[model samples]
Target: MKTLGKTILLAALAWAASAHAVFAPGEKVIVLNSGDGSISIVDPVSRKEEKRVPVGKEPHHLMATPDNKELIVANASSNDLVFLDPKTGDILRRVPGISDPYQIAYSPDRKWFVSASNRLDRVDIYHGADFRLAKRLPTGKVPSHIAFSADSKLAFVTLQESNEFITIDLGKQEIVWTMPTGKQPAGIWMTPDDRHLLVGITGESHLEIYDWRARRMVKRILTGLGAHNFVARGDGRHVFLSNRMANTISMVDQQTLEVKETFPVPGGPDCMEITRDGKQLWTTSRWIRMVTVVDLETKKVLHQIPVGKSPHGLYFQSHAPRQ
Candidate 1:
């Protein structure tokens, strides 16, 4: 009887562990539909759309607060920010008077908040704690994306129409310098060590590596046509880039700056997010109005779930930490 009871207890423990695995039933993946201004809430385990909630007009990008309490979505056309519960996809409140917040992000230190105005050709800096406008810096034409330095003292912005990269000093609230880049630079990402900047040249088909200290192009990594955006794979060594025109995603080595693997993804793969266990990749299919789930190890698309029109940004609470 004693041995039997011990065996039963061990089996119960195993069952509990399996029940609490990541991507369990209550967890969800959020997708932003830019065309229809709706948010699709998906279940990762069941791989189904749970519900759709209407947000503001033209919600392009989103980011969670530093404290992880609220997820803020930037509505460019409406000129407002909608705060939502990160776990439940419920709207908490809406804050207005933000001018064309196309892409928004918080600094590493959580002291500054910056938004790039794609149509207004300006970048707005706000106090991280109170969300008050600190300064409005006039950038070049069409500021599309933003990336900050490690220390949070400087920020880098990509100008899509002007074909330039500009850096702003956060403390002084002024443009420090600007340098020319490839045609139509859209996404900008800083290396982990803050030594190099990777600009996704949407007009061309390559990524330009620029040295920030020296202010010069170090090298160019030839990716698929329309290299658009990047996201780290949670591992310290690898990063992934979405090549929109080529309809492929490239796995790149961070240290060597070489393309390790390239997987064919369809329907204009724009933005991406990885699962917490790092076994799957979720990307927004802009043209197809769907989201594609790819098996990381096998490099095969597992499923494509139809979403609203023009899906762009994707997020989940249980995501792997960005490298």
Candidate 2:
């Protein structure tokens, strides 16, 4: 098998040369949680590790600032958030006090970074620009993941224990609505139009679509096993789901509510991110201790780049034009 970086496929053939929508040239970055108290920075296009920075422990998820200059990582074991410089992989700041910060999301305006702490059963909000503590909002129990509306007016947080999705009004910084969802929904994502929220049924391998305006379940799609992380294509018609237990990725059609295709991945793929150009879909395999890059259009594994053990999460820098 060809190793990552060594094997290069024709970007035109792989992506149909459709203006390369995923990662921009000369300006792409990859963030991976080592799952052993460290985080590594890699250039997605070059497949080279820039630096490895140590954190508290078991970094569960990560989010980059709006400008893509700084990265905030959730250290689940230590119950804190670690901030770092993405280019050099240096620790710049560490925010302590969250309990089991498992997942994170940024507001549409990118002004606030919100985290869901499973152990503390609360949601902690941080000012993105200054990295300051804004407000800690309490939830029902075991908040796993969070998502923000496109308008940045509201945030939907999944409370695993309560089996409900809590809606927080960003302006008031408080919970305004609670909508019940499937059992143990772990990850939450919003559709491109911001008209629906997709809740992953972590316990049973299913996906539930909730209409934002109607505030109810519209459709439920059956995926195979331990569905966790989800990523949507730029067109908003296709959504990719990671089946953690099955070691595979499933492509679902949004309009038809059907799984269009499934492809094998390296160990159990946890979290995934597609390049800004849409040429590739990258996933971190925890057990295999590597990052798997797949040609989304071909549905074939292009290369596997080795990283630290138990890679938990992956984050790609959004494309930004030069200032």
Candidate 3:
């Protein structure tokens, strides 16, 4: 009787774990393995890697369609965009001829699709409907990240190699302004109010806040070494930043521009995804080939999920807000 009771207890615990995630049949988490040129589809409920899906060469970053129907993976070396079914991780289609698309995004107004050709030092703008190239503006060396104004008329880009930041007038397809910034600016984000832009300086230990309207940097917020990337907590009040070199993730209050919580995570942390309920934080640990999962409620590193080499970007169908 004791043995039977023990088995039932263990089974009950397992059910709770799966129930908490509430994953459907095809629901899974997608991770971009940049070094291996593939993607890992993991079962979120079981937290086990389901399969490795081969994709284009050097798959670096990914994002969902503005309508959230499909997920797009940017393959830099292969110069293509592969669209995947958001729920099942199946390849829907591939659009080729995108030149060195290291990072890509769609503007807030859904009027433009933008790609940064990192290796070619160019920013390519495409018509939202067909993704036909509207204009390719030559930028400083290594255009790394992109953000857009709420109105979708102004697009901001960071040049890592040139240590500069620039804004392009989408209507004219020309760079209206360019200014110097700290070394190695990688990830760029706009604040909730869309008044200021936050730049992650990968070569330093802090981030620079730029007032795009005033055309000047307003302040610097010291996060940690190699502070890069931002993901909001879905509450619209908090944003998380990952410090790759420091192996830490900092949660900053957007209103105060101050970090409220700092949690240590092993391996070089890169891209992040938080659960919809805002209880768990998932980040790709760049160096260790592992995805670090943190229990936000307890502020503890739960466990790391092994994936592919040099995992860079991560996403799931049910996740927290980006802004």
Candidate 4:
């Protein structure tokens, strides 16, 4: 009887350890449902959604605070930023008067916060410390994605309608230069070395690589069609770009700047986030209203979990750092 008791206790302890190992404590995947104005909280380990939290209207994009304490959801139609507790998935507060904040992010140095107003054709810069409007610079039609230089002195924005990429001087709070790009450029990512700017041409099947220092286009890396967004693997070796129309994800070597491999991801894969361990990728399927999980080892989609309508931005506290 005592031997059996000991065995049972050991089994129970093992079960507890396995449960904790599945997910890091206080970690949950959060995705923005733009079409339905809701947010989905999901368990990465079990691949199950825990709850659906209603947020402001047209919540399209999200970003973590510089301190990593709060997750800010930008509701473009509602003109507000909803702050949520990253661990608890609870609404902390909402700041209003942010006009058409389609996409928002902080500078690398955390000195400035910028929002791209897609519908209004403007870019608003705010003081990062207090979220005060410092400047509202006019941009081309439909400013979509944004990226900051390594030193935080400059910010690059993609004009979807105008098919151009513009640089803004954060210190001067003015436009520095503008250059033409492929049609409907949606995602902009700066390489880790800060040597080049990669603009995903959503209307085309290639990514434009621009030499920012020389102010010229260097080369174009061809991938699947509707090259929408990018996320670094945080391993300092590779980055993943989602091709929405082609329904695939391409892995590119950061150093060689060459396409290493491509994996099929159905349902119009859009935004992406990588796991902390770099074993898996989480991406939102904007057309199918689901989140697809891709296994890096096999380079295949393992499964998908249903979320709300038109899921766009996705994030988790325990994710790999954006390179």
Count of backbone clashes, every candidate in sequence: 0, 10, 0, 0
Candidate 4 C-alpha lDDT tens digits along 273-294 = 8877787788999999999988
lDDT (Cα, tens digit) per residue for candidate 2, span 275-320: 6666678888888888888887788897788778788877766522
Better of 3 and 4 by lDDT: 4
Cα-based lDDT at residue 27, candidate 2: 43
Order of candidate numbers by TM-score, starting with the best: 3, 4, 1, 2
Q: In angstroms, how far off is 83's CA in candidate 1?
A: 1.1
lDDT of each: 0.89, 0.76, 0.89, 0.91
Name the candidate, 2 or 3, with the larger lDDT value: 3
| Top lDDT hit | 4
246-266 per-residue lDDT for model 1 (tens digits): 999988887887889999999
The segments of candidate 1 whose C-alpha lies over 4 angstroms from its true place after superposition are: 1-20
Residue 145 displacement (Å), model 1: 1.0
Which residue pairs collide, candidate 4? Answer: none
Task: Please report how far candidate 4 places residue 68 from its true position, in Å.
Answer: 0.5
Point to the candidate with the largest TM-score.
Answer: 3
Off by over 4 Å in 2: 1-29, 43-51, 96-100, 128-132, 318-323
